[model samples]
Target: MNTKMLHDSICRRQSIQNDYERIKSSGSEANSDDDDHEPEVNVCRISAIGLFVNKFVEGCFLSMIMGRNILYPFFGIYLNAAGNSFNSIPAVFATIWATKIFSAIFSDALPLFGKRRLPYMVIGWIIAASFLFSACLHEYPEPYYGVTNCTRNTSLVLNPRASESAFFYVLSLSGALFGVGIATVATDALTVEYAKREPLKTRDKVLAYLNIAQFFGALFATILSGFGLNSTEYGGSWCTSYIDFEDILLIYGVLCVVCTFFTLTATHEFPVDPKKLMPIKDHLAGIWKTVQSSMFLKMAVYIFLSGCFADVQSSASVKIKAYYAGVQPITTGIVGALNSFLVIGSIVIFTKYFSNTDWRKVTIFIKINIILLTAFAQLITIFDVVRNQYFYLLADETSCTLFLGILIYIAINLSAELSNESQEATTYGLLATIRLLTNPISTAIGNSVSAPFDVVSNDRYIRDTKEDQWSIAYAIIATHVVNSVSVLTVYYFLPKNKFELNELKLQSTHSKKKGLVFVGVISVVFVLAITLIMLSAVPQTQCLQVVGGQGCSNKN
Candidate 1:
């Protein structure tokens, strides 16, 4: 019996080796399913999006979205109606956007009442809700109470009340922005842990789906802000029901209550051991080390350069669209809603089809796509053939924003890999903070470039002459070209592909203190510059010179 068993085992092994050699020689594929077995279902599956299906996940998602997007289409619309330059209102508060870093740092370093994220989130939401509700109490100056029609009377926007209203408006917005920062920190920290636990090959897809909750919140907010508030102030309402302060208040007020409820109930966290906690200085030092590492330094350089140059856009584009292109408020709302819808779709496509695509190639394609779209949009202003305002629609802000979201998704994936399990929030916070801080810098740089252009003067749009159109169009074209070139300047920074990126597991010994310091100094200066421009944007300031245009009122 022993002799028979030994002989059988030897024959089986020989036959298996022969089959392996045959398959290798023939270049045939033999996957696990060669025997017709099905792939096992994993938690990372897209159907696990869990919005309606999973209540716990939905709560955290709601909190994340509220702070990030609750004030989208309508807020800008109100600013326009009230004759305030968004440049002034938003620029000063650019630092608020970067509160993600602070939020993460505090959450990691000093737990509130011995808890990490929950106490901070609850308190933060309450503060945010208070500020927003207070803002609702005081309506935008009477000029903006009802929908204002597009006319040459840019002076209506110059009312002294406009400046006062803008001041309060920005204060409330800043407070609200601060509150949501904690929400993002908590949610992102959770998401990062989940992504790390997933299998490496499917990690990106898992992270992408988890982020859909944020996108869905954005979609919901966009639809409400756009479809509900058809009164863009520049254009007439498309629906019989126009959005006033009350409606805007109600939507956001309800949003706050729901988000608060979710945050209070849905989130779960393990208690931290007091003895296990690291000092704040040590935690920060770890992050600084990562920042000085080779991979992160490269990405930081690219973010600084590209964010400053490539994404610059004049705030005046809104005024141009409304009065020059004859784009109605309803039209703006429709476009916003469409863009939000496409953002969700873009993420889905990126995860499903291009998850394994070359990171460098994907970056190149999206950057080029943005440049082309921008160039074409500018050309819409120059050419008479496609001068129809609706043709401006074909310029496709959707594609530019859509690709931008995918690019951010890729960056987040890469950033997660560079992070250590201990310093996850720190790594993410610093990177995201740099990204946020750059927007104001880019805006300031673009505004400086646009200093000579009459994109927003009363004389330019009110006169409505071909000369004004050509000059503004030409100026934008020049800026577009400059931005497009800058995109090419940072191509060397991104890793070539996934294989190379994953191989960078060793910590870099060299520290980039000087470069980091220089970047930090420049960041402060530009943020201040943008903030100052908005602060001095009162009507008396004469030619405000921000994205909103030459003055507080669209006037000279």
Candidate 2:
């Protein structure tokens, strides 16, 4: 269902983090190596090029060459070939995002070229572009590379790629994710800094702007997927269909470079006032100060648990949509773009009409809407109601685009408010890390829970038997049942509104050890998910052999 970013600083950051804690506890300040360095010139400042400049850049990165959405089918199928389940795909890619905290830390402490985010943003894009270009030249398992270099190539279902080595394929993808990921984080970091300039009442506007940008990116990805790579099988016959997925990637590589260049020219990283600057150690220590607050801790827990609860989506949906339901790429693309448009519309409507509504109610409404809509869609899938492509958009994702568009901004607004202004990224990234870490844990739990129903992630669509349909349906529904439980918890975890948020007193009773527990949790999930994906060349799924399935093809 999802994939994500990676990190630049691993070893260096640990030493830095540990030192910050140690220094904080000992009540002494050691002169950091950069105490005497000249004040940063490029400085952290918003650009005159446009309103929501960072938002625009970040949005472009999301949909443009980033390929996070477009490549989902390809990599999900590829990972399935290598023994990863569809449920596990999001978690695995989420590891890249899990590195955001570290990337945030690297930006906060290291301060590349007297600046925090810009240097990394530019450099990260360069690396990502290189990998995208490199993937074009790499010889993937020829049989599984999709139908003749494009055309309904969303992961060759033949399972031929499973029998071959995926070393280079994984390497190239990883490199791109790592590069683009850190850059994306840096871009977000830039936005976070910019967000600090706004008052709480209007800060959500910045996030809303960013959300619109993402939807815009989604719109682009849809057109490309529908018109470009889609072949006759996926209902892409409307176009001539000349370019391959690689051609798309080649375009992305160029766009990545061009976009990074835009970042350089479009905005300047204004300097932080010297009076506001603190010792690097103090800044790191302040992460504790912010996250240790009872409100922030509660928020982190809610974010983790709500998101982590029921993420048991499997690849069976792909086959069902593509084969059983006969949904074509053009249909998918058209609806996807339309959904993005709806989300933008909803955001506008909400900001204009419901801006005064309690944030808590909005959060709860979104969760409930998610529960009902997703279940309704899945129910249609299970019962074969209509068996048409448009129903999926109308029943399932329609509300998603309408309601979920404002969520990222709300999340940013809430976390930004909780964070110390001086250590914005550190606090925000710490919270984002919790959300990131939840994907894998939730996926693992959801799939494991759904296992008893005999649902599977890599069910081959070529088989025609309907005997296993009920079990798969049951498994899918079970995930929704678990997800519905998350809505109840939000009332207790979140503050009523921004007023209550500002009123809550930060509790100093918490210690560094408790804070490290959160860090430890992050480390555990990151390592486990990465290890699972790394060992994926050997089968790790617990799929049962069903009527229409090739369970775990990588199994020896």
Candidate 3:
């Protein structure tokens, strides 16, 4: 038979085989006590392989996210000193963002090489693990040094001697690999595929479950790193500790290897001929066409703004810690865990209440609430900055920040649902790309403006204060304000009636329209509140200094 005919035959056989297996499995449970009731003799062994493949793929995804989150805090702490330089912290993030963009660019081409998702997943994880392991080799001895503080508790400054540039190169490369593995291609494709499969009726639920898995994985990583690695030490410093950087990388590497083995042994790949796979250019063109849709374009904008705002929060962690002076690493870990936990809970709650509701309205509602929440949170931080009393407000800021994160999470999920099923992977990939671009651009801009104030400012400016603390707070608030406005503008200009908003409502679905209207009014109130807070609570000159001494001087 010809190639096309052979392919058709294989497809037919697969369909028949799948149906037969389904029928056989459906009846087997009824005869649990009958040992003689044999399973279908001719049923393809591929089905069993497929089940394992799916589970392994899922595990790989879980491990990737968990490993990355677990590694981030440690990596950040390791590179914290670099923040004093040309702001290497943002460069680390930019590495991640750049890798994601590259992943987006290339993920669609995987099929052309007769490869499936599993290989990319495996290779990406392995590369990540290898690069991470390299970070440990950079460890060198730090000579003991002393510090003197009159009022506060003073301790020794045991700074690690600078490892070779290759160490940082490995660190950044590992981050890029991790980003490529989890954020760019593999995870997104897996999500879309799973959504297309089981629990056929509720694809959104499938997507939500994926996010739930990610949240738990991230939480686990954070807890383990915080309590397991950071808490234990060979001495006071992480470099000299027993659970040092290399050990962590080794553990992460082992996990990735396990994930790879599981994926290879168990994951299922659909039977598609390599000859029939579309060309990379064609696939990309298809993606371009799908992104041209107005809804997809709006969704892209939403993702971009949301990602920018979220990155702003991430970029502010050092400042938040400094503000609390003497805060434990686990304290930051707890905040991170809480953020993920609340985000998961919010997604569940929103999904429950908005069941079967039109996705567009849900998306709009989430976008509005996220913008408002973020704006309010930024204002709160601004107030704390002015008062120079941020510690008291940490709990509130954490909760509110998590809530905003949840809203953005929901928005992205809803955008995934809004896209056509056939083009789901491509559409979501494009959205991820947009997020990747926005995050780095916003981060770069924030870091650029804030870095000068952080590194160059005279000590007398704030009675002998480190400019780093003030710079962080300023960057966070400024980025949030910009992102919030961008999101609001996108929502306001979005087409109102492209998709029926009422279709999202189930019998139990809450009045999303009312909720949206309420959120909209509240958003306006929050924006106004933020304006007031900026004007009243924060000194204008302080704000100007924070904004890199720009002309917006309200300093009294």
Candidate 4:
């Protein structure tokens, strides 16, 4: 019996030793795999690069739309006078904001058609390009650039009968605006989704690189278009009679289509299991929770005010044309291009060495500078307000653009930190919605307040004197002052180490239907207000330049 017991004990001890070795070996192998996961890391970077390319193309398209190049400015000058482009600014942005909201809402829900973001983006691009193509069919008459038809060699002037072409022209404009809205929303959401898949450290770098690419793309487009804006004397492709503006649309349209194809083919969707899809109720509940958060509300209001200030400043081209005559589109393009370059450089430097604490401090300083400098610039322009050098405007604009770029960088990072990975896109979309509303809201206010002063433009709107435009300038400056104060309030609510803190995961108890109804009511009311302004507000008549045998008049 003793011999048998001893043998069993030895066998049991040997078995235990073998089991321990196997467990130890498995853990060691796992640790080794974790340390040497180069393939996985490399794959993430490759995917990030693809997204970066997609954004670069988007940046180019946006630059073309926003740049003070011949195309966009001509479009503006045709629809309204170059000096009075701000007249219909409210309506244009109302459309954009409405479409953006729909696109952002639908982007998350559109996975039923296939990948959530890519398909919508492709469709949006197609729609946008198609509309631009249609706009190409009509050319801005000769009166837009100068009173004479030097290139076309005809007596044709900018049509006083815009009502004749208003229908189709407006249709094409709507399409472009809506298409841009949808495409922008989808692309923004996709970027957030892609970034979430990366580790935190890598994700920041990825966003930084992508933003750099975006600025580079904008810079490239601005430079390319600057040559075109300057092409008036040469009368080449950028000239009205040459490519006829229609072909330019075709060119950008085709570019968008081609880029869309490449983007669809190159980018991969982050895998989402069907079973993990949240029900509509849960999604609404989640959104409601986010909306109810005090921090988010404060941020939203701040963004709205900031956007108000930005819209006025973005209309600087009009202000420049009104104040400093002979500042041609080419000159505007040059300043815009310079601003883009400086913005890129500033972003690179800001990201390179700034810690979180440093970023917060720098962001505050930039915000203050943006407000003060913009107010000073507007006041100077308003009161005549001082006889300053030409470069003063450029310096102010460039500095503001630089500050804006830094704010965008910091804001994006702050947003990422505030939201969880699961709902990052939705959070961003909501924030963007608030920011976008400022466009129409501020423009409407500017239009209504200055209407009494008759600073609005007529068909042949020409800048007469600084006195005629000071009211409008003052209106814009006042908004900046208001925004400066409003924006400062947001900083207090921002927690310390916000970018490093965990997201606030709230228990959503708000009634989804009530929340939806509330949001709907707000949107409807805002849209109604904009429509009322558009219908009632009349464009103020201003004197026209007497040239090529045309006489100056009160109403064109």
TM-score of each: 0.79, 0.80, 0.64, 0.75
Write one digit per residue (lDDT tens) for candidate 3, span 31-91: 5433233222211244234333333333333333323333333433333222222223333
Greater TM-score among 1 and 3 belongs to: 1
| Candidate 3: residue 44 Cα off by (Å) | 20
Winning candidate number (TM-score): 2
What's the true lDDT of residue 315 in model 3? 36
- Model 2: ten consecutive residues of lowest lDDT: 1-10
lDDT of 4 by residue, 301-352 (tens): 5566656554543233354443333344455557777888788776676666
lDDT of 2 at 68: 32
Q: Which runs of model 2 end up more than 4 angstroms from their true locations?
A: 1-46, 50-57, 60-68, 72-84, 140-159, 162-170, 233-240, 457-466, 505-509, 535-537, 540-556
Winner of 3 and 4 under lDDT:
4
Q: Score candidate 3 by lDDT.
A: 0.46
Residue-level error in angstroms, candidate 4, position 267: 1.0
CA lDDT scores, all candidates in order: 0.59, 0.60, 0.46, 0.55
Best by lDDT: 2
